[model samples]
Target: MLAFRIVILAAFAVAAIAFPRAAIAAEESCPGLVARRGLPIVPASLAADAVQLTYIGHSTFLFETPSGVRIATDYNDFVRPRTTPDVVTMNRAHSTHYSDNPEPGIKRILRGWDPAGGPARHDVQFGDVRIRNVVTNIRQWGGETTLRDGNSIFVFEAADLCIAHLGHLHHTLTPEHLKQLGRIDVLLVPVDGSYTLDLDGMMEVIASINPRIAIPMHFFGLSTLDRFLARAEGQGFTVERRPTPTLTLSRTSLPPTPRVLALPGR
Candidate 1:
């Protein structure tokens, strides 16, 4: 009992010491920015830019281009009036990832289909953006015995920036997965640390990808975000909590080194 108590106490001490340093490390990576909380309201001029994105609750996101090309990701439930999108992508995770078709005028729909035989790779082009999806392993129905090819990691290339989304990932990324991912400028990752990989595992993958911007998603509650930020503190990534759920981003406006942008998913 004494030995066990000592081990537990030691673990807590390590975590407490590690968190502050991690936070400081995140601050040092970026020279000009400061860490601030709460959402920022986006201006109309920025909203009208060429590449604009808005978080629409949970995994649902609305991305629009100046040419009116709108794309939605994992959008199938509790979405707002702005739910209309030119294209929608649904991964094979759960019912939340898919739903009945849109009202009308919705142009394209993409699903991450992984069959026993194999999965199909999609090279999608919309306006000036290009996207590709690669399949990986994710447990189905939360069972260890029953394994299926359902989840996928999608890569989007726009404005000379490559962004990857780890969809319902259940396992650590292999070296082959790294090779398949090539170079990513921004990464939209899940940090729930329960349904998705834990904080440490998420760090491993982020380290491997080494993207310029890391946007965390699929996490609930404020403390989940805090813990994720804590885990990434000393990893040399600046953490910015944007003031709003929306952001106007382009290749030119992106930072040179890695950073974390916490977007509001509601």
Candidate 2:
């Protein structure tokens, strides 16, 4: 009888060893536990409240963080901004959006797609800024082939603001994509009707994102830009064309209603 009891006890110990109760509890209640300990929930905002965004033409925009961190999107040699960037992001759809020979001085270079035809993963923090990405599929060979996880939506978080740049997006976002994006305060979107998603599909994306401000990019001519502006205006978005290509933004400075701002660019 004592041997039988010892065998049952040994079985129970093995089960407990395989599935740790403490680990399960931690996994289920980590957030609550941190809150109870008074730990910081999110990263603190930068000392300076405003972040500057500069249009560098054709899907390339330079983001200047308050702490002097500069990030350029779609960084290729042809349309790259004059000043060197601290960090640069690229997409793989075309050579126009990426460069094989990036300047050696750049601190970080992030690519949206893996050269091996896999998904690219990036989550980096530098100074006052944090950058992350969400993967999406793209069309290749003139829509003859669909490459899985071929593009990325880069998100920059700084000064308590979330800025997202849709890089060579070829389709409407899925619910999983929205969950990954969270809340975007500023959105940089492509306005080219045929190359990226159609005008109607792009409008649907804007509505789903619901950013406080939307900036147009990737439009080759005024006609494409005008069509996007008109559609946004029809949806009750305030369309404003800025004389300059740069804008400084902060949480407090956001418009009461969502606005589409057009910056002059090549």
Candidate 3:
């Protein structure tokens, strides 16, 4: 516990010094902007240059692009949307995060781990939206053995927006991972506290990503979600509790200061 606390403290100090200025400067339209709480989020109509993200539940999200392509993240049987999506991405960390039997009519099923015994690699283009992935490691059930290249962090590029869905992430990203990530506008992150990275390490991951907007998911209850929200607030990020489950953001709608947008869902 002491060592964990020390890591948190060190991370806090580093984040306090590094993230704010960098996140602000990340967007040209956001420089010299002041951070504020309760930033207004306009319900996105998904304009010509925008994309939409609707939280289904858990780590699953339905991403709709302007060109009419749909992508589902963490395509599990437990929390799939009613309508089949054009493409689906899944992680193998848990049974609830992926499905053994996906719908045959579904166009593409991008699993994080390859069934043939290797890391999954994907770079598929769907209309104006392009989907790709960066492989990451995961801890097996009960935190026993660490599996190398067992999971994926999928990035969606649409309407000039870069959104990343970190599926069942168990560890902080390496420098190489960040290099592949580049700049991210929105992030879908897990905040289960125990199942994925604890609040401390998760915050560390957010600092490393420095996304303009972050929406928390993969939590079992409200309290677990609140802890992650509080951690982001402590790191000087503005927290916005959206009344709706869907969040729409384009380059023009991106927040100047980094923000944690809490959409209502699982």
Candidate 4:
């Protein structure tokens, strides 16, 4: 009886190890982007499938998925949302975009910069949401020198929607960057003009991405935001200004044409 029990225990251990390895292999073979075929069409009554976005001030925006996963972009000490986020993505372009000391409650803290000066790589999966990044360069503060792979464009995929947050992007994206970004349904852009990319450069970036909805962030005040809105309008984008800073969006609920949404800061 003792010999039979030992054999069964060994079999269970081997099965446990082999199952995880097979799952990992399967996940590795899958493509990075979600395919757009055979997906169920979300109905008007099923607004619960939408993802919620809330502006937290500056570049910080809180994203809540349908499965209750919360993510905060450009997380910093100042302008933090009232509720704790399950995951936080930070950029080190300036103090306003990142925090050295993050709240202990956060499950995952994804930094856009590598301490070793290499590119920051992240492809994390939490519940129904998947987060990844495409590295980009930025100009050093008060200098003409450029830092390679200094910042990241974080991509969040949930509920059949692909959302991208451009963190302190300084220049136009290259072909490789575009290839890596794949299809972005929604975009969170920085319209600070001087601090990030200039108005013209940013406009070009937006054109290249061509997201279904563009939400402006990282701007100082209304003036900068208005300038971006005006330029985007010239490019045939409809502008919708919201009284509140929160919006719930889904794939089926997306506008027939691309539009710019202005959400007031809370």
Candidate 5:
């Protein structure tokens, strides 16, 4: 198993929480590769200035850069891409959000939490992609415990675009976090209202990041996704539910106004 937070929980009472999942059981360790339940994964051949993305399900997304470097976010046991990626990012909120055993072909495995008792720090330049992270706090043991450096918001820079995945984020970004993130072209966010931050706080986070495009993820089902779409529409942001979960975009293809694109996936 990859390193997990097993230290004693903090005695301090948390005022709020981060992420909580319904199911908990012994994890089934497997190669984080192979087709997900036999779903066909179309091979990507991106242009020199474009990026291809597939919403694998939940918080997991497979991103192919212009240079053919592949990256997977929130790689876990339940969801993943068919082809092995060069890099994989995992969040430790629960088993559904991370994998106990990642496949061997993956060159870089970035964990949101550090087992050495501090925030995770990463800034890697691989192939044609530059990936980094900003540490955040999380609530553990069902909101009663606090882990100061529990979560991470990973930012990937490639093809002259900045992409971010908000992994089980608990709170809004502070000035420092925003500064570290710089400018994001596309953002992958969580919209499961109760588990992560509430809808309103998530909206606030979106505003703070102010990405050109925002895509909702970790929404367990359609009702949850619909709720987020309605919330986004009410906030004056444009909302569009795409016909497919697969996409390819570039810096020049961004919408005139910030828009929320709901890609169908688990």
Candidate 6:
């Protein structure tokens, strides 16, 4: 009986180790490729010399320029005025981080969309904008103590400026993540303090990215906003709270030093 129990335990341990690696490998496979198979590739729908962005609410953003290139990040449900974006990227960390169904007519959808066994990786170009997604640690709903599908950090580049959005990021980025990040001009970051990393860790991330412009999102209210601004200011970052929700930007508009812009979400 004792010998049988030992063999059973050994088998169970090996199975556990083998299963996670297999799951991770499986989850890391591409979903869009599976969905589309091998169809002819169509070019993105965007124009040259146009770049603009707006903070809708939470992690939702509307980016379009005079030339009409639109993109959104973490566009979950409950968007006011029901603003639809040309491209929507979602990370399934929680309900707030994703929408059950995005508004109709969305041209492309990228969900970190990994199946239940692994991480996600993809490079996408929408219009003139180029986007790259890298999978980070997978976390539970509300990120409260469990891990599921690994979250994704997206880098968006257009009109000579690069923007990165860290979606529901629950831990500090690894060196591999930094290598994937490359250079970031503008960073749309979450400052909720608890759900994401705390203020100090966030400060460290900002220092690492060293973006010319830093925009805070996912924070609760004025106080949380204030804490973030205070930290940025101490780091010698100029804080600008744009009265207008939408702002047009270009490579020329990007500054040399780090600046934090707080846009009002409605």
lDDT of 2 by residue, 1-266 (tens): 00010000101111111111121212222111111122232332323766778888999998877667789999997898778999999998898899999998899999999888678998877666778899998899565699999999998887667888999999998776876777777899998988888998898888877777899999988998999999888777778888778777777777655778898874
The TM-score measured for candidate 2 stands at: 0.82
Model 4, 113-172: lDDT tens digits are 898879999998776678999999999999989999999999998777889999999999
The per-residue C-alpha lDDT of model 2 at residue 95 equals 89
Mark the regions of model 3 whose C-alpha exceeds 4 Å error after superposition.
1-45
Residue 127, model 1, lDDT: 60
Predicted candidate 5 versus true structure: per-residue lDDT over 1-266, tens digit per residue: 11111111123232222222112121121112121223332444566667788888899998887667789999998898888999999999888778889999999999999989899999877766778898998889476687899999998877667888999998877777776776777899999988888999998888877776899998877999999999888777768777677777777777655778898774
Weakest lDDT window of 10 consecutive positions for candidate 6: 1-10
Error of 6 at 32 (Å): 20
- Judged by lDDT relative to the true structure, which candidate is superior, 3 or 4? 4
Per-model lDDT = 0.64, 0.77, 0.76, 0.78, 0.77, 0.66
lDDT of 3 by residue, 1-266 (tens): 00010000101111323473233324443211221112332334345666777788889888877656778899988998767889999999888889988877789888998889888898876656678899999998986799999899998877677889999999998777876777787888999888888888988888888887889999878888888888888778878787767665677767665778887764
TM-score for each predicted model, relative to the true structure: 0.76, 0.82, 0.83, 0.83, 0.82, 0.77
Q: What TM-score would you give candidate 5 relative to the actual structure?
A: 0.82
Could you tell me which residue pairs clash in candidate 2?
none
Task: Go through the candidates in order and give the clash count of each.
Answer: 6, 0, 0, 0, 0, 3
Candidate 6 pairs with clashing backbones: 23-117, 27-118, 138-150
Better of 3 and 5 by TM-score: 3
Clashing pairs in 5: none
Error of 5 at 40 (Å): 30
Candidate 2 Cα misplacement greater than 4 A, ranges: 1-47
Query: Which regions of candidate 1 fall more than 4 Å away from where they truly are?
Result: 1-50, 115-117
